[model samples]
Target chain A: MHETALTQNLINIACRALEGKGVTKVNSVTLCVGALSGVLYDAMEFAFDAMKQGTVLETADLDFEELPVTARCRDCAYEYNPVGFPYICPVCGGRYFEIIGGEEVYIKNIDCIGDDDVVTD
Target chain B: MSQIKVNTDLKALNNEIAAQNKEKLHSCGILTVDVLGSPGSGKTTLLENILPELAAKCRVAVIEGDLATENDARRIEKTGVKAVQINTNGGCHLDAKMIERQFEKIDLENTDVLVIENVGNLVCPVSFALGEDLRIVVLSTAEGEDKPLKYPTAMLKTDAVVVSKTDIAEYVCVSTDKLIGNIGTVNPDVKIFTAGKTDGEYRAEGLVEYILEARKNLK
Candidate 1:
């Protein structure tokens, strides 16, 4: 899986967050990437290997929550998931449907030892 | 015996940076214009005509992103504005971090407009957001009418579209109506600007007018 720059960007951002809060060893990593966000999960993991090398986020477990494309029809207010590309409402077949969600790319939380841990030389 | 729950996703960090970049641009009262298109789309010609005029009215600057070379930046600087060349060195797109770093190198406090000439690719540039207020997609008449429909991502993300090389539209067999129709299918509201660099009867003038209008709207 060749990581796109987008995934690498996410990894770089995560690394900064980890370092900022003094997260030496991350217990788990969870992300919510929307279908429309155009983020590839496999590529993200591929980038994590090289991007996190020699960093505090070296061995963090990367978890991803894939978001589906949900749309609300403008004509009939019908909400539904996209069956395929060229997203259109199934019930009303509305050409224009506002994107309600599934573009989220953020961390919910992290388990890390706050600086009050064992002494380090 | 204890249990810990750590849910850290690094992607949020980039998103935060993107937000911060947007906030900075917003506070400056400047509109970050992202110019995206395929190779040889006459993006340079459009800028060459518009930048000097825009700079005369308001403080303007450019952040040029490309696979390599300062060619586009060099071209824009001739119009008498600070053009910072960001050579991506084969990268397909420009991300928020790249734009954020460019901000440090240039001053946008008094600047009224920030034009980002993104790498010439119709696909990848749409995937990355550089915190721009508006994304402009340029297509030359020489590129054909089916361009927008084939590269839907670029059209979908664009706030405006410019059909360049309009003077050569007849020779190239590029139908203006068909091109507009394709763009309309994807983005019905996007303003379309027809432009070129022919001496007297050029459409470049109208394009500059649109840029001015965009500036006023951003303000």
Candidate 2:
């Protein structure tokens, strides 16, 4: 349900960006979904599929890029991606750290089809 | 075909409004805090216990965000302070836009502290900024100690982590020390405190004191 609201924001962005571009339809929207952003890819795509209509993004396909959790250890300042379970620093075996990445959720680009039957990336 | 670089933060517009809301609240001398936790995690109960103590020091107002019902709002109002409820009506979390609209219902002139009780969810609320000065996540002991590990964003982004319902810690498998250790794994700087357990009339005092201490961070 949260994804639905967030996906609306993405759709709005596409609409606003292509407002005066003479674009007939949106081909796709590329998004970066961070692991810590708590956005579900499938859920967001489902939302976009259902909600995109009567707008520039009516036919838009959502392309997602999954970003892994990246953090730096506090004890040893070791940067590593903690995959699963036992989150520990690979270099110094430190258990404590702060997440520095994989928290951003944003739109990267918009691919659309212009009025002249030309597809724009 | 031309490719346009949107490269825009999806939350940029919302954050802009949130920054504006923060300034508006601060200019009115109101300190805002977002209280977050999972469903049935004793968030309302903790507030009920501490509202008097907090109100005694400053005029407190609550903005309750829930998927449905004005239940939390009614509960907060019983404490004899201003309360407004925003029913998300199926939304999982409260965003800045919702807060911006509902905040106007509460009088900013007399309000010294504004506590926004975020919708019950460990996942989505972390992504939305509600123009708050601080964020507190109340983790009930019954919710398991692995919560901090599972929802690291909620713990890391929050200013404080309150372990609520410690009186029943004996009934639960999670130990207090391990819970604190798990919190350190994500955010070592987050203030951790045990609260919401009492034998005689002073329930949630620790949590109240913790919240009062956080007032120093307010502008």
Candidate 3:
């Protein structure tokens, strides 16, 4: 029940999509998460399992697309992806940079079952 | 059968809360700074010493996150400023939702500086974001010089590193030089400071000055 709120939100969104599309059950839910998003995948999964127990997504699968942290240099305007922490500009060696990409955590898509067949929504 | 359709990202709710908190902080031009460190690393002591110095110049608000006890909050309140203690119960790190809730209780407009003291753990706290202007990690000499290398994540994400307990550096075999070198290896640009006891009082002028200078740089 710790992630009840989060789980409720997830189920609400997923259930709506399922019913709207005339799908009887939701097979899985997919998400795209950036490395810098600061989300605990394990915790989210645990919360999902606990939260979806009695809902329409009781047995839905959760998929994740992990993205890396990418930034652009302020000095040279060079763009690059940072592998680990202590981000620096790859081109100009400038410490100052803007995070132009990564840090994305969103619902990329979902999968559902319509009538008696599997479908992607 | 009528079908009901809804397309929503569940995480959006949390993100919305985070955005509101960000806007509130932005309107006031106040920067939220997070202080992270391991247990027994002299984090509270460093803050206690610097609070009065910083508070004298600007209105500072503190959000202290701990597994238990409001003791740190009490200590910070003695500085004659606003302090809120967030008890995480058993959570290892302080998440944005918790901070978003805390932001509601503080008047961000009057606050010039906001300091969030993260739960005492180098590993977990590094992975969690609390929307801070700068993330400073505190390491004490007693914790050994290899701490930065051992807990590379904390050092890697930090904008600065504070080496505390320099007052007893000679008594302990902690290689301050080696520690600085290792820290530079992981994060070359991270501002480093050493706070130790000098003469009759603890001298942390460098660290204090860094904070003051940082506040001026904030937009």
Candidate 4:
């Protein structure tokens, strides 16, 4: 539902990072999306396609690398990927655990053409 | 083409602003709570019931977020505590920048506890940190027992859960116990509270007590 807003932020951040770097055109934007990030890839792609128009990312491809949810059992200090609801530790059967990863979306990198590569019209 | 390794969190700006809000609130010795839930989940009712008790002990203020309308702010104002309304104008969630703007309107030094009623939502609000000391998610019995499982991110991020409208559980054929069990499944460390009528009297004693205790412990 908020993919459009998120996509806008993605564009803004990418543009800000490229400021004064003499970048000519953005080729692709890569993101690291987590399983628990609650972002729908299809929605993100759709929003990116629509909002990237007339922007630095007009021709950029949206790429994603998914990260799995990982947790650490507090009782026994065991680390594992939670399988389903009622996430009990497989090793120690402890229910108490802390989520350690897979809950964030990060912009990994951007592929761009430098100003030096631009052909004179 | 060259790849620039930007490697930045999408929510970095919001988180940074949230951290600043946290420090500002902390310096003022104010305890802030962010309340999140779906529309019609009894978030306002829960606050209306608890605010009076809370106000009696300390100076309390409310920041209400909604898609449109000052109705909630008006409701909170009826309780005699000051309320600032922020209409998101169709935005799904309230971000840290919005809260930072409210600091100008609210007298933070005079307020001991600041309760922010987030725009009613189960999903979008889960991702944005509002610089709250405690984050609470309210779930009504009418919403059913599977919400915690279906919206694990909301359950995972909240510090506590309030199972509201227990008074209608029987009619709605909802089991509060099952709801709580599901909540525990997703977040084993989260505190849980229930609020509703019991024996013709509306009650949210546990939740009220919890809030007071949380504030006390903050000092």
Candidate 5:
């Protein structure tokens, strides 16, 4: 829903990261999106495509790596990927568990071309 | 051609501001609660019932977030407590920056509890931390029993779940027990409360008491 705002932030962060590097163009931006992050992939891509115009990332391709939900049972100390709703520990049927992964939206890295990489016309 | 490593959480800036908001509110001895739910999930109605009771115990202020309209803030003000309205202008959630901007308008030192009614959304608001001490998700019986499971991320991030409008559960063919049970399935540790009219009186004493207790525990 707030993908537009988030995409703007993504651009700001990338721009800041490349400020002093003499980068000529951004090639791609990689993001790690979790299953439970509540970020709709299609919406994010749409927002990126629209908002990236005129920014430093105008030509950058947005790449996403999806991570599955993982949890650890507090009772039996069992760790496993949760497959369905009402996530229960497979080993002990314990409902009490701590989510250990798949709730984050992280900017992994960016591929860019430095000024040195551009051939003279 | 180079790949620069920039491993950063998208919400890092918001979280940083949230931590600052927490410290500032805590320093003034105020307990903050962020209320989240879908539109028409009875979030405002629940607050209308509980705010009077909460105000009697301590100074209470409310920050109401809506995509548009001052209606919610007006409703809150009718309880005789201060209410600040934040119109998101179509934004889906309230971020830490928005909450921080309201601090100057509110009498922080004199307030004991600040209830922030977030823009009615079960998705986007769950990701943005607003520096509140407690995050409460309000779910109505009319929304059905599968809401918690369908929106597990919202349930998981919340500290409490309030099943509102329970008075009409039977009329809606929804069981409050099943709803509460489903909530526990997704978030076993979350404190649950129910609010509705029973025998011609609004009931949410458990929720009121819970908030009071949370305020008392804030050191």
Candidate 6:
């Protein structure tokens, strides 16, 4: 559900970014999906596929760089990926950790197929 | 075409709005907290009990979120407080924009504390920031002890966890110790409190005090 809003934001970003570049079409758009962000990649892709219709991203490929969940323990400053279910910091056995990574959802880059850029077959 | 490098965070716009909300709320000196839980988790019950106590200390207001009903707001209004309900209409969670719209309707200047009771669900609300200074996740004994493990995000992101409906702990098979322990395993720093039907009296003393403290120490 939220992915719909996110996908719409992505399209808006792409369109605005496309300005002044003379980009005719967007070939593909890459995204960095964080594991801890709680966004289901498949759902987001599904949303992008459905909602991008008739928009600037109509023909653009939606790609993801699925990142790993990482956390830093505030107690001992220990950082590690939770291997088990508890999500505890392995070093300090502390569950309270400041999530440093794996919660970021961002655009990496947009592949624009302009009149003068490299053409994709 | 040309490769136009553009890096944008999907949460950038939302987070920006949330930040703006935070600034607006802060400028008004309103300490807002987002209270979240499951559908039947007794989140509203906890608020029903605590709102009066909170009102006794400071000017308290509530922004209740639901799928399509103003029922929760009606319930909170019975306590003689200003409560505005935002119907998501089918949305899973309440976002910053929803809260922003209520700024005018909520009587911001006179309010010392604003409690945003988010759409009752365990998942989506954890990901959406509603410009709340603190996040509280309420879980009742009836919901079982596996909530923290099953939906860890809600527990992990909250500043406090309220174990509501403790009076009926005997009826439910879930152990209070086990529930709190599981919550600890998820987020050790979260302040935990037992609310509702404690020792034959409905009380959320610790919960009320915690919110007041949070309000007093607002950033």
Two-way DockQ contest, 1 vs 3, winner: 3
Encode model 2's per-residue lDDT on B1-219: one tens digit a residue: 445568777788889899999999998988899999999988888888789889998889999999999999999889887789999888899999999997669889988889999999988898899899889998988988788888888987898888888888778877877888888776777888777557755475466666676665665
lDDT of 1 by residue, A1-121 (tens): 1145655655565565555454457655566776656566776777766676776667776777787767777789898877544566788777776667665565555445545543221
Q: Write the residue-wise lDDT of candidate 5 on B3-42 in tens digits.
A: 8889888889999999999999999999999999999999
**Model 3 chain B worst lDDT window (10 residues):** B1-10
Q: Extract clashing residue pairs from model 1.
A: A14-B10, A109-B7, A110-B6, A110-B7, A111-B6
User: What's every prediction's RMSD, in angstroms?
Assistant: 5.5, 2.6, 4.7, 2.8, 2.7, 2.5
Compared with the true structure, all predictions reach lDDT values of 0.73, 0.83, 0.76, 0.90, 0.91, 0.84
Candidate 4: where is the Cα deviation over 4 Å?
A: A115-121
Per-residue lDDT tens digits of candidate 2, residues A1-121? 4788888788788788887778766678889888888888889888889888777788778899888888889899988888864568899888777779888888988877676754344
Q: lDDT value for candidate 4?
A: 0.90
Q: Write the per-residue lDDT of candidate 1 for residues B17-124, one digit (tens) a residue.
A: 778898999898887888988888988778888877778888888999888998888898888888999988888888788899998778878788899988887776
Worst 10 residues of 1 chain B by lDDT: B1-10
lDDT assessment of candidate 3 = 0.76
Residue range A3-92, candidate 5, lDDT tens digits: 887887888888888777778888999999999888888999999999889888999999999999989999999998998777889999
Task: Please write out the lDDT profile of model 6 over residues B1-219, one tens digit for every residue.
Answer: 566667788778778889999999999899989999999899888888888888999999999999998899999999988899899888989999888888889778898999999998888888888899999999998999887888877887889999888778778988988999999987878899988775676897677778788877885
Per-candidate DockQ versus the true complex? 0.22, 0.49, 0.27, 0.51, 0.52, 0.54
Candidate 6 chain A has its poorest 10 consecutive residues by lDDT at A112-121
- The DockQ ranking, best first, is 6, 5, 4, 2, 3, 1
Ranking by lDDT: 5, 4, 6, 2, 3, 1
**Which prediction has the highest lDDT against the true structure?**
5
Candidate 5 ranges with C-alpha deviation above 4 Å: A116-121
Stretches of candidate 3 off by over 4 Å are: A1-19, A33-47, A69-106, A115-121, B1-15, B103-109, B127-131, B142-153, B168-173
Candidate 3 residue B67 Cα shift, in angstroms, is 2.4
TM-score of each: 0.73, 0.90, 0.75, 0.95, 0.96, 0.93
Pick by lDDT: 2 or 6, better one: 6
Docking class of 6: medium
**Poorest 10 consecutive residues by lDDT, candidate 2 chain B:** B196-205
CAPRI rating of model 3:
acceptable
Fnat, model by model in order, equals: 0.23, 0.57, 0.17, 0.69, 0.73, 0.70
